[model samples]
Target chain A: MVFEEINKKDWEAIATYLSGEMNQQEAVDFEKRVAASKENEAYFKQVKTDWEIMENLKQKNTFDTNKAWGNLYNKMEQDGLLDTKSSINKFKLSRLAEIAAIFVVGILLTTLLYYIVSDTTKKNWQVADTYESPEIRTIKLSDGSVVYLNAESKLYFPEAFEGDVRIVEFEGDGFFEISKNPNKPFIIKAKNAEIRVLGTSFNVNTKAGNDRVEVLVETGKVQLTATKNKSIHKVLEPGFIGTLDNNNIKKEINTDINYMAWKTRTFNFEGVPLKKAVEALNRAYNVNIVCNDDRINNIKLVSPFQNKPLDTVIQVLCELEHLKFEKQGNNIVLMPK
Target chain B: MNLILRRIQKGDLKAFESLFKELYSPLCLYANKYLQDKDKAEETVQDIFYGIWKNREKLDIRVSFKSYLYKAVQNNCLQQIQHHLVEDKYKQYVKSEVAHFHSDPAKEMELQEMNEVIEQTLDSLPERCKEIFSMSRFEGLKYREIAEKLEISTKTVEANMGKALQAFRQNLKQYVGVNS
Candidate 1:
């Protein structure tokens, strides 16, 4: 064993190896050689001990005695160590509880700051994007309520809804999502009729002609009144279709769930007959669809379509019935192949 | 020191702090010798001193107060080292199970000599060599960081570190033994 013969290179190698500058494979290989000889291991251990004792330089020279005492004193106070033994443990626990309470309040304030910094609502007084077109449009009112207008429709609304009731007038078809405010109600004046919204709800006035206006309630309650009669009114609940003409108000349980399919482009048909389905599809997509045979009327559909093109829904629908749809004149005809 | 200890036993916080001011750094360094972690070493020493003051009224000590602190800090560090051994660290010192309470008077004398040797060895190095050594060991600056900060090449820093460690090795050669 080479006990007293470590050269300069060996010392430098040990220094770099202990500094962790040497790669893992190099350190492992070096460790194997060092552990093989007792003298080599002792030298390695000596270097390791020297590395540890290096801190003595820091302690003896640079350690701030006053700062260290201040820290220990603070810790002792926190742990109730400075207290006379008679009441030490109790003070320590209360001090810890006080510190914990400060932390909890700090966390709550930080969460509130995050919310204030990243508030999701777009804050502006200027209204944007109002129009009538062949495509759909969405308008966000000042109250955070949204209005979706179908083609051939437009709204007359202010930059911000004013007064106790947020009243917006519109022509043709539009979907109103009135925001909830118990103190202020939302009223829609469309085609000589009014819808008083007491709560936040999704209700679509699918279409409003000179003589008729239709309302379908998706959620919450809406009272539809014919402005011409004043006494003719109906409270429509969810899944109820309320219609107001110049004479009377009519409401019924709406089985045609595809009323919003025009703006949403999503169709949910459950056990609906092909003929009746075609009728609703015509009103929704504004397309002409004809399934002429009475035998095809009993062919019930139980499929759903979301944002699908009219041709895709037709093709899938035909495949399920062993039939096909072809464009014939202005009508898309569904017939047996 | 014994007078201060007697005062501390009578609930004299000022006396306790006087002893703390005198020995805090050395005891922290002593604990670091076993743990190799600065914060844990400081924590062990503070806890030992805190335990003494908290239970001073019921204290029983046959050894000197400094001796008691060294013994307590060593035991705490050994307990921590053993605890980390359960986490599979420091497996190289598995035989450090051999160091649970090795607080003999000879060991204390050897450590006292080693501390003096470290001071002498560090003081004897070149000014730049000592800075590099302290940067690597105390400030935890990498050779690259030290090189950048000092505007020297990394090779110079490494060589200085090597020279400093070698100087201490030569000075403390009296402490290393030929046993397994």
Candidate 2:
């Protein structure tokens, strides 16, 4: 078929070929026709390019659903639209406070509860260590299990394992790379759920105000059970995510694979908006990076920075977007060029 | 929709949060195409969500929640464009709002420039063509899937996608010529 004189069927054929919706015969024919001419090859490349660009834009423009919920929650709170009888309270925490007073209170409550649980349950050797940060903290327990705590996160473990089952409590988010010990099963206690593991590496994230603990397993097998109902449990293997809340326990093959960005610091942003990126970067770096203008968030960054300093990352991002930045007090203020 | 909508109607805030998380990103992106303002787009979607939460008990949706959301965003975006007076002020919406990049800086810049052209070309297509094309391209729907969701035939989806591509090619003729 002539390229310029292509009809509707020809267009369908091309679409199918590009979208991988073609049958074998159609694919062979189309491939042969396109490969026969330089012009055809170029046209095909253009179409492919357009498709790829759209896909990239879709990926990059994906806003944080969690953040979006937080934003909507704020709006609802402002109007008093949230259900008064519901337990899902809105925290309105912006990750940056002069002293993080609410966070401190939360930590205190969590620690107090840890002691109470240890005493009531008749567990031995309870030790709670809270890590607040200018840097991510790596904690090594007596049993050789290592936990990397994100900023403002905490981990409470026993000084020594006194029984066959070892239990630890985690608040906020932490990555655990457990040392393999078959006899001693490891348990993670969070607000709404408990994760039991034989020997595994996983990340547990429990956000404030939301009574849910999200666990993503990196390696090995683990069982996640709701705090209220032990019978409702999910056995999660590697690449699986288990989310336990007051209502239910769910397990799915993880698709949001970049949840480890906080722990790993390996970013893959193709065209993410600046504001969203800053929100995440601020959490990871434990600094205040504010984009005063909403328009600046539209500026996309494709930084795949691995283990880079916050300053260097900010500088590169600013230079790429032609944005100006300077230190203001303890925060970095990004301005339009 | 079945589980969450029921709970939301009964004033379950957590259930409402689940629904919001599922649809927020796509809806915001859809609204942004028309308003060309991220804040406005976000505000528009947020307003709709807030409305849903507030009136959950009396919820009346004829279509699936997914369809209802896309339609709502489309309607809001068109309304914003029609009533929005300061077009020139927001003229830099697409270019200034999004930073486009790939690994190679040169190719990334080219792709970034092409994004504006592609957006313009999309705007020039017929309304239905634009919708079908976007559902396939942005929402990552298969042709048959778009057809089923939009209550159209697969043939129609293919044809509209064709028209969209043909239009894009004609509009970007100059740019393609220089680059390719």
Candidate 3:
């Protein structure tokens, strides 16, 4: 029978039969029908082709939720929108508890002295520890806290964390892994804001001349308060972030985790504006990324890179985005299609 | 489709989660066809979902939900490639490790050619037939699975699959004739 002559019921029957849902008699009858006419055979093949195409298309449409969620959590943390204090606190207390309880007092005293001397002896303290430019230096604190100082950034902490509270002052961008000590909360002083954490992984960016201070949390929690006003405190959990300007504080949650990928020598951008991505590339590689075309700068991109060779990255971009680039020494210029 | 649209638009996290789960692998495979990088494809799909969530309030749907999603994925993949071009020029040999993760060029080219043919054939099928065919072949769903997913009887699935296969056979008659 011609395709048009086949009723909907017959179509349904054919579908079932092909699916092997029919009885032996039904299969035999269907086979006979197919053998009876070339038209029937042609129709059957058409349906099969259609099914294959649709199936392929369907497979192409599903998204990986786990990775998506992880990225979201990371983004939120990078943005400083989540409350991470509890986790940080838990991490800190556990570390503190691990140390020999007998020497807790001595360690505490030394930690106190370290913070005091680091803060007071700033100019006199020979750059005993120098982190060269264009490198991230991760320093382990006495309380087991870790600080990831961004390139061209400097941080002053004591030989050991000490006192009722541990405090450190930072310049540029750095991600902190504070060891929780509820009795002595860890505080970071950057520009005009004070970031408090028991123990958490978060980034604080305060580059020179940039009027805003940005904080992002990867795991655990933190509390950020404007140093000028204590009541202006905002709590953050994992996947949460906060940005502080001179007069405003903005909080957002569930950002992509790849935001903090710089610490891992990888940069991930998910639907990031072209301008922002360029800025990140400039910062990470310490080079200039210029978009000559205004339209090109406004386009958004979603991709990840892990220590990718500059040439390969460019090739991928050209092939995938249909865009061109010009390399002028340390400067890379981006142009539109 | 309307229900999914409504749920997605309302910031229903569960709906969003389920939607991602349902579409992730397929979307990645689709992206891989064009980009040739599984990781990039996965990232592109994630970005599309994130974009949908971020701009859900302002979204205006004029086509099937799946169509919109596919288009978005395509756009993101293209944009990612473009951005990489600019950034790659400045940085030195940083991501050599990742470059090695992609399939060899020969395999990629073959897959690309096959994809183009499949796409053309898919476009030529009747609307319902095309949908059912894709649900089977691309999705790797059995006939019963397709019937259950589409809420149709198993017999209908068998009929549609047969019709789809016949269509593909005719459209690709030249290639099939030479090969067979």
Candidate 4:
């Protein structure tokens, strides 16, 4: 059995229907054709899906709606919406309520600033703050523990430790030197992984837009667990690291010893290759340094730079290695003298 | 008459947010079709919404809310392209556009794994035919508008569009169950 292929008239009908150009009569005629045969209906649906697939293809995975909302909120704050105390108190702002509130950012910031100012006296108010890095922030928890948030990190905690467990929500990276509490455990909740400790010092690093969260215990014990499956957890002792990379948890010896460089503003590279040293400097200063020469990587460096500026570190490194360095648009290139 | 638009006109932030949630993705997708850069597309859409919010009280809605937003995005994207062209960054624009179009490995694999169905079918289309079809579909240009822009007749535009659609349907016969 042979069936006739859909002709130009049917194609025009599809285009008209799709583009919403069909008048009432034309729409009725097209509907009759579609209703008369399953083939016509199926063809129309296929064309529609094809159009949709193209539209979907146009959507790159980079536009995060939540982050876009955050940016918009920041702009609103700049626009003087949250300036007055009346506006703050009138809305009775909370994060969940702000979602449905007419005044969006003012409500969120009112709740945030209110908690920031009165968090010490008010035991019930929880405070949330987001900090972008290269701007490391020192956060003092009510329990006397201190957290140093790395650049591009968010930390949300209560004004006071209310419950049995002192919990804080995190995204991105931070270093925690938690105060000892025998009865209550300090927990950092990230997107996929949770780190729990009674009292300890450790570094947690998770890159934004990447699905890898790493926790390295510098002192005391740290328990790293999947947020979804608590049973799948790992306990790390000092000098050990646990990583939830691509949904697989692995415990390994902490090799990247300069994880605290972001917080400490210090770097220690002993007998390491120039590549390793350059990588550390790049991370510490958020600068781009490339030494791709065949002979560059083999050069060893044993240097300790403490609390020095980025240019000084580069200058000292260049002097010690007998290399001349040039800067190009936030990037430094080192070549043998 | 969108309830969200009405509420937004009355200076309601929640309704504005609701409107953002509804139209944001479509706007970004539409902008990306022109800009071919995700960050720029997002920024473009964000700026448009920000303007809408800042001037919500006096927003003159001459058309449906959806069409208004779409038109605004189209105008902004065209202005951005013109800006790029003026700065002699049109080469970079084309490169980035090609890179973005080819960047989706998952979509490529899915199109192949679903069957050699949709991916390679368009490779056979003439360059002019493909451009005209895409300008119509992606740019939301009318047949006459496309004809004017391309310096061709409306009849030629329709003929090309019809050929492109027929080619797609013909190649996609097995996938679409055209005969079955």
Candidate 5:
């Protein structure tokens, strides 16, 4: 077949057709034209490459606006943009008010139940010591409750469980194995949510910006409630996960034990988002990962590996996903196939 | 610059504060491109600067301040993404086998560079072409949407897109390796 001369209009038409910006009829006509000649096939490939480049370019320019605002706030704080003394005063006053309210409530409850008030004094709780390094630490509570603190995690607890229940506060990711104490329930206070349990094993991850506090139960049953709203309470059974976000509680059946696998260095992921997976790798291995493909960043993966070397992981990923990786010192770069 | 550096080296709170103000937004913006979630991105950026401030006295500014900021932001963002991946992997142990892979870093850089190239190319185009292209692509408006935004007819939108694409392709073909 004789090859027709390709003009600038032809190139634009091909670009539009590939971009899916063309009308239905226009696309169909363009496809027909491409199918008519070998030259058209070659031209289509060229156009396709050009279009991919354009898409890549556009994706790169779009930055997350929310992050920008956060940076500004932090900078202002560091620069002493706000009155430090006033801010500290405000914090102290709010804390004092909270304590006073708790005291008033405690007094009222004490009057109603003298026996419960007396029992509160005998409880012993011990919190884990603070660690300067970002290392996952494990603690065994007095009541035989086991807690695994993620890197940079902090926990606060009393010397021992007292009164009607056992309470502990955590500010980070932690996994718990509560002792079977039906009479004295175990309650974990993490940010805006609370996890209550009666002898159960579960993972509670309350990372910042994660609107919901996630609870994945491995054994027994767990109850999750948003601290801000008592009405939002969810009961979760073994192989179940619950989330409390925006004062809303959502429960979903989850049979995956690997979801709580931070206790082990091995990470088992299934259809996890690329960005999320990268985050996990960095935290687990303390390495930097830079993605060259924005589209791939959102792509999900399904794979399981145990304590694999980072290079091996990257190699397997590249083979399975048809992707490429470039190492620049401590940083690993991810690119498309 | 040397005086500011000396103050930062000495752990002067004021000097650190001033530096934070100057570099915070750009660093955050840079991190946002990698991690799409705004809150997470912000947290990562904040944590980095806070870490720097806490260790300001020991920090060695061996290179341009820009390089140091970029390096810190890059490391933090990458770490955040990798941490999530490990969590997902754990979640997958009992569940069905599925994998989530991140984009290639080289490709991301290439794309960023290409974007810069495209922006320059667009700037060189006629004002009407640039506006139409931005309206159609950036705003994600259909031809009709672009027409409405630009107060032009659908035909004009189509025509302008065509022109813009043609100009872009001609300018970018070499970089994109688009040879027929």
Candidate 6:
């Protein structure tokens, strides 16, 4: 009724508000004006009705659905909208590729983790104290390497092999069976000699007065360098004996099977000299033996001594050589009857 | 979620028709907002949905089907306006100024009056909003930095900042950001 009172500018603002274009403040301001007066309220209703009719006319009069569909279908035929399963197959192929990439990445990660764990296992070592004893001492190293220290020997080994080499300072004797690690070499540091071996079992001995050191190889190889003269070293093979003395260093095929008798206490000597048998017995028992008569040189002992007591072996020797024996403190004197 | 679109991609004509019928008029009206010519707007929308049917198999839409259609119509409208730059009737229409009108002096006087009203409204803002707004905009500090300075959580700062921005929008209709 009072549509004329609501000016054209006011109509545009009302239309803007109807279309959700007015911000909160503008909408509130316009709504307040409508609520204040009956004329403004009637203008609001009229504008809202006009917008509703316009939207309906847009769908009914302007958009002809059938005509548009006909045009779209003709255009589609011209464009050749193909019907096939190729696109589906393409999606499947891409999915397979994704799975394959994930598999390869998984393998790479596992290999990397394995190397990291194994490298750490090999590189880390704990600290331990040094080792020495009078009797034969079997020492298992922190790195699982082992050395058998013989009696009358002083082996001042590192507490743990915390380095790239397994090392020990030696004075008397030892039989070493080191674990096989090519990275960490086993070394014997002696008074007159230095013996180095990489993962092998070997015997080491130093005579009284600290004059000599002997290394006999059993498995793998051994290299003995004279401490007094470094250039004087020998690389001895299995069944080879390397002797390092104050003045000389030499290696020979180990034919003296009794060279291990000090550790084994077992011997098979056939027609060996009287003095030779006594020497084997003395070494096996750690005793001193003196054969004072010249006639005993012609005597020969043809027998096997298998872990026999020292007194029995000596009695057998004295009877066969027609000799008498007297026992001294840690000593035995043999004489012709 | 795009089940109808998937059917359309498989050459289902009925699915395509349902889609076209549901969106046809609304899309035309949206395009007319920028083109200002109902016939051109209808033609643009028909071509877009027609192009959709032509290349249905290659339609790789990540967003909702309706939103994708609306966005495609918007872009096409902008492109047409750019190509026909000499046509001045629809050249100045931007998406942000959807229902704005160029009035003689009445609207200008209204905007001038709006500034005074905003000054009164802004000066009378809630105490908390006034403090948060000055700390953020006037002091030129980041939300997290402001939170740390004020000894509050970042979420509390964000909420207060939203309150302040809402207050500004209530006074200044053209002001944007913080939701822009």
TM-score of chain B of 2: 0.47
* Model 6 bad stretches (over 4 Å): A1-135, A208-210, B1-180
lDDT for residue A5 in candidate 2, whole number 0-100: 72
Clashes per prediction?
0, 3, 102, 3, 50, 2
Model 2 C-alpha lDDT per residue in residues B1-180, reported as the tens digit of each score: 466677777888657766786667656766665665778888899888888888887988766666666777777766776565367655455345432322233343455467768887888889999999888778778888988888999988888887787777676666663332
In the range A174-230, model 4's lDDT, one tens digit per residue, is: 889999998998888887888999999998878623888989889999999887675
Q: Provide fnat values for all models in the order shown.
A: 0.53, 0.43, 0.35, 0.23, 0.25, 0.13
All candidates' TM-scores? 0.38, 0.42, 0.47, 0.40, 0.39, 0.38
Tens digits of per-residue lDDT, candidate 5, A148-192, equal 887667788777666677888887677888999899988888878
Q: Name the 10 consecutive residues with the lowest summed lDDT in model 2 chain B.
A: B97-106
Which sequence of candidate numbers ranks them by DockQ, best first?
A: 1, 2, 3, 4, 5, 6
DockQ of each: 0.22, 0.19, 0.15, 0.13, 0.12, 0.06
Off by over 4 Å in 3: A1-131, A254-257, A269-273, A299-303, A327-330, B1-180
lDDT by candidate, in order shown: 0.74, 0.74, 0.67, 0.72, 0.69, 0.66
lDDT for B50 in candidate 5 is 69
If you assessed candidate 4 against the hidden native complex, which CAPRI class would it receive?
incorrect
Q: Per-residue alpha-carbon lDDT of model 1 for A159-241, expressed as tens digits?
A: 66554566666776778888888788887777878888966565555354567888888778898987666568887767667
lDDT of 6 at A197: 79
lDDT of model 4 at position A249: 82
Expressed as tens digits, the lDDT of each residue in B1-180 for candidate 1 is: 477678999988668877997778777767766877777777788778878878888898877777777778878877887787866547766457436534453465356567778877888999999998878888788889999999999989878888888898888887775121
Tens-digit per-residue lDDT, B1-180, candidate 6? 899989988788668887887677666766776777888988998999988887788999998787788778878977887787676654455433544533223332333334344445547888765665556554456666767887887666556554544444445544221110
Index of the highest-TM-score prediction = 3
Off by over 4 Å in 1: A1-134, A206-210, B1-180
RMSD of each: 26.4, 16.5, 18.9, 20.2, 20.9, 40.0
| 1 against 5, candidate with superior lDDT | 1
